[model samples]
Target: MHTGDLAVMRKDAYIEIVGRIKDVIIRGGENIYPREIEEFLYAHPKIAEVQVVGVPHERYREKVLAGVIPRDQADPLTLEELRAFCEGRLAHYEIPSRLRILASFPMTVSGRVRKIELREEPARER
Candidate 1:
């Protein structure tokens, strides 16, 4: 697929989709896998779900922004809190510099989170 997908072929000739290739954030030339960061944060008690996206940055061209849904609505982690949590566990580049405490992710009828719509949120709000 030309839509930036990572896939694998099995011995039985089945094509299995892995992850979205375009979701990779190139920050200061470091490859930051959003899924890895998302999974890492899932282990934290405060985080219920997270979606990492790349936003424009003058220095790195792109930086990480995490859309977090808290386990407890009243206890959403601050950007600094999340940074502290990821400090030694994840590489510095993989840590999110910004956060959006979302009520819920925009989803398609097919049940997939619509990252395309998520990406356009800033523009839409203007």
Candidate 2:
């Protein structure tokens, strides 16, 4: 069924729903899954929480952006550091092109991250 859910069938015959079709980021003809990137970024010691979203880009149509909550407010994560950390770890296109340090992610009443709000945020705030 084409339910707009991105899933994978494991060798054990279990289906894993990774993300949604609408959430996929297409950059330079490459498909990037925010959930995959978010999972990888969760390993970063400096990152307490992270959300990956696609934003407008003239060249690629869309570009990867990361919203992160630093583990320590005193020592926030930097874009350079994030890129460096992603190097050799994630694909070139999968690396976040922009980084935003958010105090808290906009959430729904159900407690889900509001990605739509993130996409609508002003460039200055991002």
Candidate 3:
């Protein structure tokens, strides 16, 4: 049973699924889970939806990239603003370094987000 899910066992034998192994981002030797970051970003009032992915980095192995769909298209979110929101909340290394405002994410026929498409897009640096 190889479900790609990464989980942890608690003292009570309860299983907690943190994220998927394929989506883990290794930045500067740090393991960053995109699912955790996505959960945190959902707290933002302006963000309607978000997908986090890793992009190649020259120095670090990879960097976090967030593709967001804002609740209000007229008022777009900024990288600095997102950083400010994440500051102190999430680990500094886990914060998204790049941001892409997308109207809608690429989805499969099953209605699942196609993160592979997002990873293929050119990352925009702030």
Q: Would you list the C-alpha lDDT of every candidate in the order shown?
A: 0.83, 0.93, 0.93
Q: Per-residue lDDT of 41-75 in model 1, one digit per residue for the tens? A: 99988999888887778789778889899999987
lDDT of 3 at 73: 99
lDDT of candidate model 1 versus the reference: 0.83
Q: TM-score order of candidates, best first? A: 3, 2, 1
**Colliding residue pairs in candidate 1:** none
Per residue, candidate 3 scores C-alpha lDDT tens digits across 35-89 of: 9899999999899999999998889988999999999999989999999999999
- Cα displacement (Å) at residue 119, model 3: 1.1
User: Could you give candidate 2's per-residue lDDT for residues 1-126 as a string of tens digits?
Assistant: 579999999999999989899999999999999999999999999999999999988889889999999999999999999999999989999999999899999999999999998887844454
TM-score of each: 0.81, 0.92, 0.93
Candidate 2, residue 110: Cα displacement in angstroms equals 1.5
The better candidate by lDDT, 2 or 3, is 2
Point out where model 2 deviates above 4 Å: 122-126
